[model samples]
Target: MPETSLVTARERAVALLGGEPDDATLRRYLHGIPGVDAVGLEQRAAGLGTRSIKTSSKAWALDRIISLIDLTTLEGADTPGKVRSLVAKAVNPDPADATTPRVAAVCVYGDMVPYAVEALGDAHGDPDAGGVSVAAVATAFPSGRASLEIKLADTAEAVAAGADEIDMVIDRGAFLAGRYGLVFDQIAAVKQACLRPDGTSASLKVILETGELVTYDNVRRASWLSILAGGDFIKTSTGKVQPAATLPVTLLMLEVVRDWHLLTGQRIGVKPAGGIRASKDAVKYLVTVAETVGEEWLQPHLFRFGASSLLNDVLLQRQKLRTGHYSGADYVTID
Candidate 1:
């Protein structure tokens, strides 16, 4: 939109939020955005899923999917050895095939950041630099029930431990209770906490846990709230929730990102985490990104898939494409 257009979605957003928004301003801004068209969104997402990828395109998609994965291991039993293994996978992905592209990052809990960083060594820096990044889950991941002080501390510790990115979960309870201000403040504060002792800050990915969000409209609101609060990426889940990362939910988020770009010329990242285990399913999400927000978002900086078993499936599919048949279980690692 033209800067001088006077009336745009962003301008409306600014006006709704006011200067330092109170509860009324928060509700007004969040509730003011266009409500989701549930049926239309779902049908469009399904249509995108059915779109075909030819042989050559499928090969390219397979590699692109590999590059876009945030190979994750977020469990209570997570060990340093497991994190190193995850890092090794992120750095190599398929050891037999040297040509196989490395993944974007290895996501682990905050305490494991050091191990992930240690294992990555010099190969851990920037994803765009042909290196793997270490992402840490913080802010009471998948729960977001802790105090703001604790949440900020969680993010700070991850950044201090050399995490390249911080995936912080928002408080679904507060969001569901219509406490938009509380959620907004928490996100904004966490974003600040991502800043390092040095000038550079770790990129913050806000997890909405869309499964608990209940409605598409709620997802839309949470996406906007995350961006407006300075989130580097709006994520769909923490991999602990059910019904995570559906095509329709991801499509809705991409639409919001598309609109944000059009309105303000700012491109925000989107991540669909969990429940996406198949190569075919991952390809569908790739198609959705291209169709919804354009192929520019196909890059690692703009899109990511959070999954533990997803890389295994992508690797198996890659081997099949090369040898014309599925490989044995040994071809991929067990997460």
Candidate 2:
């Protein structure tokens, strides 16, 4: 389809959900989604994982991986000083090498958005000017066990505090209990709460928490549910749960986003957070994206790795590529 037609289709999809959808309407929409083939899905992801990327291509992939990182720090003990340090590292990932590109954004809890924004300075205003964006994890994050009113308020506070992006978690209980309408409504409500006072809202990334979903079929369903609810991006995990961001899970998400774009002409991003700590692992994800979704999704806006230590490993690999030798842990700053 033509690009213009694709855009129109996506716009129409969003417009169609302008009003509150009834339970029956949501059920019919969800039930209409095709089932996933677990064996086939696993095979495809495993096959892609074995593909080789070498030399110059590897270097290019490493750099691209750095740019796609959402240098994250979501801990109960998080402080302004720690956030500032993280922001500094994000702005200049490779302090020794000025040629290295900055990370896409710094992801923190809602309360830390102001500190991150302040520390980031002009980069927050103009990401193209070597600046980074601030993403806040809200909506009873990691676990959507709160009331809808509280969740919406959490999202609104983040956006109001200068968060350029909001990463929200869906109520897995509602989803598992076949409460598709409730899940859809919660996501739509959060999306609405993302809207800023100036009419420019933070981009919404709905985290499906695939590990808890138990099956590939559920992951596929959750992906479609988020898309239909107007999520700008569909994420795999919150990084708090075990078995986060696995190759097969991320691969499935990539496929979903690819299919969603083809069907709607509106491109949605994918983020594989948690457990992706190595440079090699990050490259494998890049390979999967290039092969599954094409190079267009290679940019930071369309792809992001939700990680903290992953940045250090990427920097080390970059140094090795430039110097033909390995660098020590001391070389990179600790997040």
Candidate 3:
């Protein structure tokens, strides 16, 4: 396929972001959304310990967990070393501080995957070491405004450079303009490029940037469309928007996947990125999956938390449970 025109694509993406939604559609998206209930959400977030233990055991035993921890702290150019250390910590967790769950993979921007892959390679001797998969953000990430060819080549290069997973954002503009076929074709092409040189395929995660879509109906339609178009996972955001990943939005996507699975007998994954900072917040997302998507999606293959700061709180909470002391500075900062 020829490269899409970048100038045109960017204009289309922006227009879609600013478009209006009608009444019934707006109502559907807002369905059952509680009053921004963080307290209630936290109350529902009680199972982090059980979830973490389950993740560790499943990963150790059946390798069912995604065992994921993400790093998209793109500060300056000195990021390679930072990412390498982050990956290392996720694998060989600090023994003194037992809060970090064994992550299944280390995810970074496309430019940083090679550094993480090398670090993970150095730490490959540990049993914890084997779970180190790599995921790279592609397709003009936070803003899905790149040409289709650039997106495909971006995915291809990441896979070739050793990313075990490719997370691409759907062109929300196309979907908003009622061009579902264009969006679908773009995703399919990228999925094709995600294939390894020898014909194996890396996991392909499609980020809908749900907040950008701005309505529940759009979120639902995008979710369903993404799954039908061959998305192995449907992610919530680029973590760069005002409303990155919200429970209500995730709830909507959960329904889409639930119905999709019922209809097609195929399970798709969910990733809620952006604004997920605290360990409690991460657990809330897991609880949402467990309650809405069923106990099965709680495992990593069907679920993952995409955040840079979340691991520390998870680790801190874990340490408090294990050693009975709330020692601060238990984890290294991503910055």
Candidate 4:
């Protein structure tokens, strides 16, 4: 086949799966996936971390980082007022500065989706506007210990409540127990539940929660498993785990997405959640995306940072770039 035809064929095959997999077939596929080399992966990540981005480029990256944030608040004590405030912050990250770009999405718990949708309506004319997608964490979020039925319902409720994106967690217990098929099927089912009554489906982000996975090889396997099961984005963590979203873990995920695109002609996204607090750390992630997967994944459609405090630090950096001095916490909203 011609190269173009081959690419088209692979895309067609991937689209047919729609994020679910046939049990036996998916199991066989999972078994065939190769493992990762811990030393090589960590060395590459460390080397990439050493690349210095200059002043102008750093300013450009700060702006892009602002746009890529999935400003999140997934606490049990979350209230409607808190969700509304977060929605406001997501719509306008910097009230004092008009040049600052809006975040990619506002991620909240399933129950808060309605409140976020309502609050965001005044900010943007359409709920599905590209400026800020309302993402909800479902599937027993943070811990994927719920039954499959409850998890699917959790996803459906979020979608029905007006979420444009669904971030679901994979069952680490099942994965660790060698029940790859169960993990694959649960993600597939949740992906299907993301469909709205109007036939549109919210983008599905499968959170691997790499902190619990314990090894680079497991992370690689989970990343590929999520992709083959129809995940639009493979996320690094739920932000609840201790070692969430480290450089090496995220680097492995970036490599997987890059390789998946090469093999399937489908481009999946990556989000590194938890512990990515500083502007410098965010810039390092952007550098990884640019170097590992090229500039195409630099956009919000293919990349995201699932963070809350990272936004304010990014705002501070943006201010520094604009006025040549550091800004205080009072300059940015306290969401």
Winner by TM-score:
1
Q: What is the descending TM-score order?
A: 1, 2, 4, 3
The global Cα lDDT (0 to 1) of model 2 is 0.82
lDDT tens digits, residues 1-335, model 1?
A: 11112123234446547755445777888899989999999999989887866644767888999989999999999999988888888888888999999899999999999999999998987777678888999998879889999998989999999998999999999989988878877877787787666557788889999999999999999998887777779999988889889999999999999998897677889999999998888888988999989999988789999989988888888888789785323232211
TM-score of 1: 0.92
lDDT of 2 by residue, 5-54 (tens): 22332355446544345566656666666777878888988887767665
Clashing residue pair totals per candidate (backbone < 3 A): 0, 1, 8, 2
Against the unseen true structure, what C-alpha lDDT does each candidate score?
A: 0.84, 0.82, 0.66, 0.81
* Highest-lDDT candidate: 1
lDDT of 3 by residue, 1-335 (tens): 11123233233333433332332332333343333343543444443223432333321221222254554554446488888778767775655744344676677888887888888875432223446677888998767898888888888888888888889988877778777667767877787787765656778889998878876667877886676557788999988777888777776678778877786566888888888776545554655677777977866667777877766666555656456563322321111
Which of 3 and 4 is the better model by TM-score? 4
Clash count, predicted structure 1: 0
Return the TM-score for each candidate structure: 0.92, 0.90, 0.75, 0.89
User: 325, model 3: CA deviation in Å?
Assistant: 4.3
Question: In candidate 2, which residue ranges exceed 4 Å CA deviation?
Answer: 1-20, 126-129, 326-335
lDDT of 1 at 178: 87
- Candidate 4: which pairs clash? 19-229, 19-230
